[model samples]
Target: MSLATSPATAATETRETQRWAYPALLALMALAIGISASPAPLYGLYADEWHFAPITTTVVFSAYAVAALVSVLVVGSISDRFGRRRVLLTAVATLIAGLVVFMTAGGVAALLVARVLHGFAVGAIVVAGSAALLDLRPAEGAATGKRTGVAFNIGITIAVVGTAVDAQYGPSPLVAPYAALAVLTALGLVAVILMRETHRDGRAVALHIARPRVPASIAADFSFSALGVMASWSVLGVFLSLVPGIASRAAGTDNLVFGGGVVAVMAAFAGVSQLLAVRVPAKRAAITGDFGTAAALLITVAAVDAGGRWEIVAAAAILGFFFGLAFGSSLRHLGQVVPAAHRGEVMSAFYVLAYLAMAVPTVLAGWAATTWSADSVFTPFMVAVALACLLAGGLGLRVPRLTPDAVPAH
Candidate 1:
């Protein structure tokens, strides 16, 4: 005879699954974002091996952002309507495919294709996986936010450092990193499969390209926060896309460890800053992000001019601190203003603005480097980031805090 399961046992099993789901999603998020940066240190090697110009490197790099932008605009909300589990699984599978293509890339065309695949995967995971984390997090303090930053930073550090080590010491640098990423993606796929479905909205909803809409009530606050994010993310985009290669050239060495270490230092500090920001007041965090990044830019200019390895490393860490403060604080403030009903839209818009800022500035810098030199690009961008910081910080202090409407904070 078939026996009925007891209610207590079922509840216990549910609790156990809930406990594991939170960390599982965190791991999945870390792995997805980490893999996104895996190709950074290898860009210089590709340029050298293929005899491509610096512009080609930017093209390959920008391709990822461009494709990610499209995915965010179009399919970002798919998981909200469908189940998060399916979307996350698809995202991991796509990441795996991207890694395979990346491993066997023979030309720029293939590389671009791989990055496009990665972009789509990143877009989906960033939206779905992040929401999943929030859903699985316990009803307590803002622990979800802290874990989000930590997971991303640590994951990126591992991917970049691991790839760099592989590139530096492995038999085949180009193939080695991608192989590692392939394994990571496979593991992420399994984790995603095991994750419980957190999103309950399985009803179909119409999908369209997401656009940013700022109500007059919160326009100033939104503008200030968006500007802060733009300034910080632009700096990050530069490091991710170009600094690895430039740091190698500046240090007069092609050691993969050197390039990867620069990024790892920045990412580690950024993560740490985010963890610390939880205790600091929101406005203070924003202030720090603004001026801190501005100061870091100055150091970056000096590091490049002097061609000192340690200086670049120092600059990267400082810049990361500012990035963490600005990005994390702005997002925290945004959470205060945006109503629960509209959180998805507003967050998506924020991401679009931030990504655009990141891509456009980096592209312009790339073109400037082509016209003049990398140093020339750095000097002018430093001025711009500093000016932006002053403006964002000044306005951020003035803008009043936005109180959420009747709706809850999602």
Candidate 2:
């Protein structure tokens, strides 16, 4: 008999690849997201080297969020029609281009371009990659979605800490992180190439890209969840974009590694809280995140006034834990209500609000820092966050509570 493989063997091999694709996609998601945050710790260095304003630093940070907002609004659901593999490949290629720009960037303009490219890549990956993960998930509903949250927290933590370590000790602090990330991303590209396509064969939608809209039935539920995301992510946006400068200002030091570690501390606590969220009710979890963030803001102000590094760390840890609980639980609640067929578009709509919260408030904080003083920034955000949390809690009471049977799985 000929030793050539039979069609049945080939089909079995294909099935095995598909089975592993779920975890493979999760790994790629972590890598892609991690690389996206690598540059954050170095923004201070860029300012020092290039002599840009503190506001310019915020501009650089907000550039990614804004581009992501626009990208998600426009092409967020495109993978629903085009298939996930094609969209993911495009994301990887764009990310590589962004990394190349980062490697060679000489000015803030180049940094902006790189960040915008990075944002575009992340936007597509967040929507398409997440949808693919959901499609390939071994389980359904909140259980599967928690895996995404855990993956995200893990990725961000790596990026923040890795950049810190490389910048503090390595030669060419700015260049080295990007170079290493480029290699990782290259390997991720190969992983994407081998991944099985999750999209079913179907007629393509006439309009591949459109503004994401919430359906009428899910609108109220979406609003509550959106508020939770907005409140939670807005606090995270503060830490991601402004906390480094704020912490440095408070501590009277410019140690790059310390700043990066502060950011990592925030995410580290967040990752821990996400693990604990499994036991908490989603509504109580949302409220806890909101109220907890408001409480953290107060602690942060005390920490800043006290000028104790350990206190600052304590504040960040508190905020991070609540941020994790709030954001993840909000997402879990939404996943239970949003229909499977419209998952891409609906999640895109939710992200639009979330990213907008991330960018706009941070930009305004930056503007306030410039027009007023660096010291003036966190107080207003603190007030806004507290008020938003209060509102989220009130709204939380009005929304229908989630149960497993509320959403029928396919």
Candidate 3:
């Protein structure tokens, strides 16, 4: 007779399997996003080889950003219809294809195409990967899903370092980074294959591109949650885009590595802070994060004025810590409030706003900086971020800590 396991045993085994899948999913997200940034350090090399103008460089980068936004609009909720594993597997394949195209690209047009592929993959991964994270760890989706931000920030940090190193010292600068990322992502695909399908809804639904819909269940909470997120993510966009230059300016030296280190330090601190955020209630953490973000920005500006290198480090730590608090907690708030069946679409909506806040205001700041002096622009930008954070904090104060019936808070 064949051996058989009881239902209790199977359920226990399933839980055990999910415990392991969580980390694999986190690693998968990190690597997928990390691969997208591999081209950053090599942009100069590509420009030289392909004879592209500066404007073309912006166009190429914008192609990725726009495709990412479009992908979120289209495939962002695809996982809700299909299983998360299937959508994620397809996304991983797209990621590998993107890297392959990027490695082989000989001109701007090919590069643009590669970027669009990469962009779509990144957006899809966030949509499906995030829902998978929530499904795999049902009770702690807020705290667990918050790790996605940690993974995302750390992934970019790793990519910046890895790409820079390979481009500087590897035998084949253009090919090595993409090759490494492709291999790792292939491994991630394997991990995704091994993961149990979390979405058990076998109901057939017509497949098509979708706009993100916020379910009525959590609509009241989403506004404040989004405000905090926008405030925090804007910090990321600004620091990533301009802090290296800020570092050079403050230090009165052109040590490019030093500037990169400042940004890296901030991201590192943010991840750590998010990891620590589990101890606090979500509402309190998010409100505190909002206030902390405002204060951190002021502190960073003060440190810049002081012209102390170590001061910048302290400032980065403070800024990142607070940004993490706000971002992680706000997302956690949503995770606690959203219905299980609608998790995919709701997260897609949240990320759509996040992507917008991360990119649009920063673009506006850059435009303003170009027209005026960079020095003058900082003041108003700082004030604006502070005001936004204050508004989020005010809204957060009105809503008590939320918990869904499906997944009650700890």
Candidate 4:
């Protein structure tokens, strides 16, 4: 029964297994990312259709983040017990339901509900899809780690770009983008059904819900990394929520494609930066990239205040590149610090921080826009984010590196 008795047969089986696992996991991640980004381009359209103000639109978006927060707190570890495939299926089903609600959205209430459901779907996907990837790692090779990194980058990039393009130019503002997502979710569900389950037997007996725990050994490491991630994501939240509004008012670019193109360009550059990070040390790349992000955000603030369209666009592109590098580095650092058993839980914590960062700043920015000019609002926001980035970078420099043996086995 052992592979040593028949090395060739074992090798063939290993390759075949990976052949299915990696692609399946990548598809799941991409679908999640796609759904997450789908709503960004349509916010302006929804504002007109729902007759809501900027604050209302931001609330609608924040509702998704709120739901994701709840999901992470309640069911984030469900896959650890129920199995990754089962939870993944449930997540996809929720996504389809969310899309349905989105396509049928009427008033702000309906939009809020749709976004909440979408957030739940994203939370579930982040936990389950990541666990599935870890479970599907190659049976006997170092290649699995590198491949997993690549898969993560590709999946998120595809999702961001796909959502941006569809929302911008697909068709009707409300119906077309969501309907397209529903189809993609369905396709992903089918793919999941065809793929083999990665985690089968070792289901935990505890059915009671509990809070996520970060082991002490990894806590300091996680904290340092999470701060950087939070700073970057906060910038992203503001960009996603208010940049379109700024573009319309300052540049008079009312087209959906133009607005979405700004985000798409940022995401594309981030994706490119992530692919490049494989050649560099994660820590070094993160520090360098974070500094770049702070610089870009400052440039963007200046451009926004000056009403320079091209400058804003260039700043966004550079910001996107740096953010991409920061994201890949953070995830890779987490992979290094956390053990496989606690991977899902740790990632859930990381994402909870990220989503909170994504939600809160936008809500505050929306409020600020009501009282102040976009430039005035962006000034303080940029100042706050820059300060946070500096703090993170300073802390990162002080934290000692953890050897593999130093990382906890559990």
- Which candidate wins on lDDT? 1
Of 1 and 2, the candidate ranking higher by TM-score: 1
TM-score of model 3 relative to the true fold?
0.79
**Candidates by lDDT, descending order:** 1, 2, 3, 4
Cα lDDT of model 1 by residue, 243-327, tens digit: 8878888888889899998999989998999998877777668877888888888887788778988888988888888888888
User: Which pairs of residues collide in candidate 4?
Assistant: none
Candidate closer to the true structure by TM-score (higher is better), 1 or 3 = 1
Q: In TM-score terms, which candidate is top?
A: 1
Per-residue alpha-carbon lDDT of model 2 for 342-384, expressed as tens digits? 8768877888789888887777777887788667767777778
Off by over 4 Å in 1: 1-15, 138-141, 403-410
lDDT tens string, model 3, 82-144? Answer: 778888888899999988998898888888899899888988887778777776666775556
RMSD in Å for all candidates: 3.3, 3.5, 4.5, 4.2
What tens digits encode model 4's per-residue C-alpha lDDT throughout 49-101?
66666777677778888888887766645776777678888888988998888
lDDT of all predictions: 0.80, 0.78, 0.75, 0.72
Show pairs that collide, candidate 3. Answer: none
Relative to the unseen true structure, what is the Cα RMSD of model 2?
3.5
- TM per candidate comes to 0.92, 0.90, 0.79, 0.85
Model 1's TM-score against the true structure = 0.92
Poorest 10 consecutive residues by lDDT, candidate 3: 401-410
* Candidate 2 global CA lDDT score: 0.78
